[model samples]
Target chain A: MAADLAHLSPLLIVCCVGLGILLLDVFADPKQPKTFIGYVAVVGLLVALAATGWLFATGGVLLTQPYFAVALTLDPFALFGFALILVVAILTTLASVHYLPSQRCEWGEYYSLVVFASLGMMVMVAAADLITMFVGLEIMSVAIYVLAGFKRQSPFAIEAAMKYFFLGAFATGFLLYGLAFVYGATGSTNLNVVAEHFAKNDPGLYGIVIVIMMIVAFGFKIAAVPFHMWTPDVYEGSPSPIAGLMAGGVKTAAFLALARVFLTAFGGADFENLAISWREVFYWLAILTMTVGNILAVVQQNVKRMLAYSSISHAGYILIGIVASRSVDGGAVAGSGLFFYLLAYALSSVGAFAVVSMLGKDGEEDITYGNLAGFAYRHGFAALCMVIFMASLAGIPPTAGFLGKYLVFTDALAATHMNLLPLVLVAVVNSMIGVYYYLKVIVFMYMREPRREFETIRSVPMGIAFGLAALVVVVCGSFPDTTIRWSAKAATGNPSADSAISAASVIDVPAPVATTAK
Target chain B: MEQVIFWILAIGTVASSVAVIVPPMGRNPVHGALSLVVAFFFLAGLYVMLVAHLVAVLQVLIYAGAIVVLFLFVIMLLNIQSEDLGHPRPTISKLIGVIAVGFVSIVLIGFILKDKGMAEPPVGLPSDSTFGTVKTVGNLLYTSYIVPFELTSILLLVAVIGAVIMAKRRL
Candidate 1:
């Protein structure tokens, strides 16, 4: 019990703070600016972030209590995810202080919901059991659904919320049924226990079917292609800052959870001997996601929609990292590449969306390319910041995006069993194709003449958020070694991963049987 | 005698469930909802036969007593009309959708038919007579599963907040 408290302090702090904010909203002065409460939420998140760092330094959650660790464990991987999510929340809160009021939707619950959502992501990354993961996912998804529909007056906002809720609920059903199947096959929901069971017994075809179902469910959350029909509409309808939160923080959490599940539970001998391999599924998924995302983005006139498709394409690149991680010699580099790329993508994306929030003409979403004509002439500094983000996104040199793509591609090339060289070549071609659309945004900003006197609104908080994000993107890109090392540490700290490999090598392949049971 | 009772309850449960969804019967949703109560009652009887007394009670208390009343109240409050529901045309897309659903169902049936493990299931049934009693469930939920049990409260709290915020008349 004593050890459980120590392990759970970070989550406890954030959860208490969120509840405290809700109570404060109920009792505090109604006339006060909601932005002050937003600041308080940011402070609370910073405190939680510090606590996470302290916990990571000490050791994993429930390190002394194995029983509690089965439910939730704050390993280095979880701590890294917590930090990324906190950064997203902080940036989002900063930008929202200016955005919510401008949109006439200023409510204290908005900040509280953001805090609650971050708490959800924290729990999700730390969860070690299927039940715990499902609970955390619901907390996060429910909060996000409310945030998406925050602007109730707009039909588009309502539609976005409704569509996201129904589809997200459907995906959750698939995930729960898949978890049920896994439990039926293995007789355990705890990841390590399941892995140990598979190590001893042949999982047969049941394992492959369950894995595919889980992948499809997670595919929707990460906005992978074929499961990505809702991305553009949701991104366009939600407020810009919330859209940023979904694209950056939510994606990071989902990818981390997916990687943890595949690398830990399914990383053993039984899975290796299966008739169907997950690596091949991911290979085609990556190709289709990249090509389709880039092609659709090329013709999008709306900036928000274009960014949405680009986010999908980035998911493709991250999938490449997952594919490479399956190989014996490539797990560490490829895993680290996934995290590094996520951080880079998060920073640049938040910065880009913050700028977009400021570009609104007469306080509506300024999405059309025509609205951005001659933006460089009117606001030179903001335009320069935007250029940095756009260039980084296009994978230009001396930017974090370029280093991220380089690492992931090299990791793919390092795979010994699979012929991943062709995949890398295809990725390179896709990246080349991606440059055309990304540059077009720059062309509109710098080359075209102002349509209507270059009128726009500027908010200090948004500017601050953009500046900080831009600085990090540049610094990380320039000094990549330390960040890469940190990501590698986060990736390699999974305790079960090493043992699972040794267990896989000694197990004999069993013949298929008519009746399968663990 | 026990086997005869089990077969009777199983047939009743299936018939009531079918009554709830077989259309023109389901076209009037109110009638469909009413039939759902009978289905739940019959399902409770099936659970009783399985010796899952706690689940059987919940199936009655929550599904039959509370949920059915809630559904009827919502239907009355909404005041929906049969005329308001548009008659959707069957198009080529609809045909494709039906075919796709048929394919998926056949595949599912194939998987279900292939797995024969459940046919012989008497190796380790719970020996304790009180396995599915309320006391046993309460103890398990509060002990080993305490964290998830508490987390469920938080999920409910979030749902309440979301509903109040989204459905309130004004900010």
Candidate 2:
């Protein structure tokens, strides 16, 4: 019981903070009095971070025996996801401190929603059952839909909300249908049970269909091509802070959940019995998502819109990691690479959006490339940070983005050795294409001169947070080993660890001895 | 007798679904709402076939009865005309929609053609036991899925508050 409490502490803290903020809003004046809701949120997230660290430090002590039985597993992987979520939450809260007031929509619900959404994300990454995962997905998505359209009066905000809602609903339907099919096939929604079914049965067409449906659902979540139409409009219309959260927090959680589902539940020899291989699907998706996202980003004039497309491109890169992990012998390396890249992408993108959030004045800042002329001269510190973020995003040397790309490429190369050479080539080319837009942001920031007087709102706390994020981006870039090692460990599900199912249960059953006597 | 009812409900569902999507030239919102009602009723019938009689009843009560009424009220209050259907969709969007539906059809047909072995129903399960009926569902909802079940209620409350807040002239 105590162990359960310890595992749940971070989520509990977030919920309490959300409720506290809601209560505080009742007494506080509506006229934004430099309210400390953002600070409170950041503090709450920091506490969650500390709790995660403590949990990790104690190792197996706080790792409760699957908290909700067949539903949730409070394991090291979940802890790792919780830590990532907390970091994103902290950065988003800090960004929101300055960003919200400028937009004239400084409501307490913003903080509450952020906290609640983070809690949902934590739940999503930790979910061991399909139903639990769905609940978490809905909780996170519902909050995000509201956040996306928080500025009710704006037509763009309304449109963004409508687009997100419509597409999100459609995606949910696909996901639910997929779940139904999986249930129909295996008569169980438990991951381990499904894995066991795969091991025991020759999954013919039904298994392939179910897997395809699941891929479609996850494809929408990760913003892969053909299913990625909503990304730009939503990101462009949303408040920059919320956009940062969507890009960083939401994407990271989704990727982690996707990795967990695919790698742990649906990979290895058992999966070979299924008529269709997921590797081929992922190979195509990775190539298309990366190539298309990068190409689309290149044409975008709006900085936010460009970043949104850049995010799509990054999703493609992460898909490469997923594809690699599904290959014969590249699971561990690719999985680790995926997590590291997710961390790098989240930090860089969040920081970039933080700078973008700062650039706005009075809710309507047209952040076109031309508008950012001479930004370096006007906002030196912000411009420098933006440069760092851009460099990281462009995968330049000594940046976290570069290390992330390095790991991903290495994994891709390894997978290529196992007959995935075409995918590797496509990914390599896409990475080159990705550099153009990321560098374009830099060129706009440094080379161009400010055309008009760029009025800046100086929030000390926001500035400090941005500085810290920039520092992490650099530090992680230079010293990538620690994060890489941890991610590797996290990705390799501890089959020997105390859980309902043991590693032996996962091993392939050797073909029954040939009955020569027959 | 049960198979006959299944076919009837399935046909109704398909017809209503078609009606919901297809209304030419500035159809009234109430028409759309009514079509949704038909769809919900058919879905309830489906629930009945699945032995989830309680869920079917609730589906009709909540979705068809209450929700459709709410939709009608909103449409009346908004006084949205057919011409107010906002902007017309672009040709490209329509083309994309057609392509998407085509793709879905192709995939569905492919699966149907694949001839995967049909699942065998669990044997010895009593037909009259109400295993998937309302009582069992409610029991499971209250016990196992209690958190989300309660959370859904809270979500509805928040949605109510939000709607009132958004629509009210003065808060």
DockQ of each: 0.41, 0.25
> Over the stretch A76-148, how does candidate 1's per-residue lDDT look in tens digits?
7888888889888888888888788777777888888888888788778877777777888888899988888
Worst 10 residues of 2 chain A by lDDT: A509-518
TM-score of chain A of 1: 0.93
> TM-score of chain A for each candidate?
0.93, 0.92
Candidate 1 to truth, TM: 0.91
User: Over 4 Å off in model 2, which ranges?
Assistant: A32-34, A60-67, A273-275, A326-334, A493-518, B24-26, B86-96, B106-124, B142-171
lDDT score, candidate 2: 0.75
lDDT of 2 by residue, A117-161 (tens): 787788778766677777777778877887887766667877887
True contacts kept of 2: 0.05
Query: Residue-wise lDDT of candidate 2 within B1-171, one digit each (tens)?
Result: 977998999998988887887743246667878888989989998987787778788898989889899999999999998878866566987898889889987976676555434423335557569677767878766644544554454344345434543355543
